[model samples]
Every structure is written in structure tokens, then in C-alpha cells.
Target: MHVLTMLLPVFLAFALMLCKLFNSLRTMEVQMGMGVVLLRYESPSLFWFVIAFQCLVIGALLAIIYCAFFILSNQVMS
Candidate 1:
């Protein structure tokens, strides 16, 4: 329940995709017409506000990973 609340606004699409994929793998009864997928969530403001910060954090992490991989690859070649 808490996870649903937290992910409702920001990761709603991802969560729904996961749900659909999981449902297809088995008969979880979560299958419904695509039109019925409503995302009427509370605290939308919280998700909107956090989106930018989350993007920055993810970007920073990716940058670090890229740098680390580049350095390691250079070392391997030398």
C-alpha cells in the first residue's frame, strides 16, 4: 500500500507496465481494458516536485558509472 502511494504519481507508467507484464506471465486477474487504467493518485505535488531532483540524482549516477568504466577500460588497454 505504501509502495503504491509512493510510486503512483512519478512511476505510475512503469508500475503499470510491470503489472501488465507480470499479469501476462500468469493469470493474476489484473488484466483489464487499457482504457480503464486510471491513475487518480493523491499528493501529486510531491511527485512533481521530486521529479527534477530524482533526474539530477540519476544523471549524476550515470555520469559516475560512465567515468568509472572509461577509466577502467583505459587501464586495461595500457
Candidate 2:
């Protein structure tokens, strides 16, 4: 459980970094489907915001889980 607390954030950070790096490549090819062009891309600021939000949410969840477990375990001991 404690290992997860450290790994979760690291994994999120690495995922975000990889996404940014891939987006930087700017390798979007035009796709024509049913006479409609489809293009998918991400802006740097949007990417950054996503990463930041993910970190925030994950951090909060971990804190909450930690607190709940700690309290429950202590109560059991008492």
C-alpha cells in the first residue's frame, strides 16, 4: 500500500511526460472519412492542466485512503 502511494504519482508523471513528448512530435496525418476530416491533437497548456489535475486528484485520494486506513487500524488496536 505504501509502495503504491509513491508509485501512483510517479506513474502519472511519467504518463504525462510521454504524452507531452508525443504531442511535441506534431505527427498528425489527415484522415478523410465520409468526406469529413478528422484531426486529433492536444495543446501544451491543456496537457499541463490535465497532468496537474491528475496529480492533485491522485494526491488527495491517497491522502484520504491513508488517513482512513490509519484511523481504522489504530481503532482496531485500541
Candidate 3:
């Protein structure tokens, strides 16, 4: 029980971080138009996209690793 109590908070924290990361990256648009005028800007090309994608992948991988370790520790403690 004590093991779970400690590990749960860490899991929640990771879940929140992943949620925020995804929310922030969810809105990557190049153009927004209302009909009166068209506004567009190049935030980043394929290069930037690739970079961001890599970061996301790495972040998720690290989170998974952390989760795995947390579970292992919890099991070992019991």
C-alpha cells in the first residue's frame, strides 16, 4: 500500500506532462483564413517538424521507461 501511494503520484505527474505535451503540439497550423483576408506564415518547414517529432518520440520513450521502473519498484517492494 505504501509503495502504491508513492508511485501513484509520480504516474499522475507523468500522465499530466504527456497530456500537456500533446496539447501544445496539437495545434501546428500554417494558415488561418476567415474569408475577408487570408493570413499565412511558415512556422517551420519539414526540418522543424522532424525535429519536433523526434523530441516528442524521445519524451514519450523516456516516460515509458520511467513508468516501467516505477512498476518494477512497486512490485519489488511488495
lDDT top scorer: 3
By TM-score, the better pick of 1 and 2 is 2
The clash count for each model shown is 0, 0, 0
Give the range where candidate 2 is weakest over 10 consecutive residues by summed lDDT. 24-33
When summed lDDT is taken over every stretch of 10 residues in candidate 1, the lowest stretch is: 23-32
lDDT of 2 by residue, 1-78 (tens): 564574576567656655543553354422233764334453455545554664676566656557655665577543
Q: List the residue pairs that clash in candidate 2.
A: none
> Model 3, which residues run further than 4 Å from truth?
29-78
Please list all clashing residue pairs in model 3, or write none if there are none: none
lDDT of 3 by residue, 1-78 (tens): 554576676667667656544544564432222643211234456535644664676577666667667666677543
lDDT of each: 0.46, 0.53, 0.54
Q: What lDDT would candidate 3 get against the real structure?
A: 0.54
Clashes of 1: 0
Tell me the lDDT of model 1 at 3: 33
Q: Please give the RMSD to the true structure for each candidate, in Å.
A: 13.9, 8.5, 7.8
Q: Tell me the lDDT of model 1 at 8.
A: 49
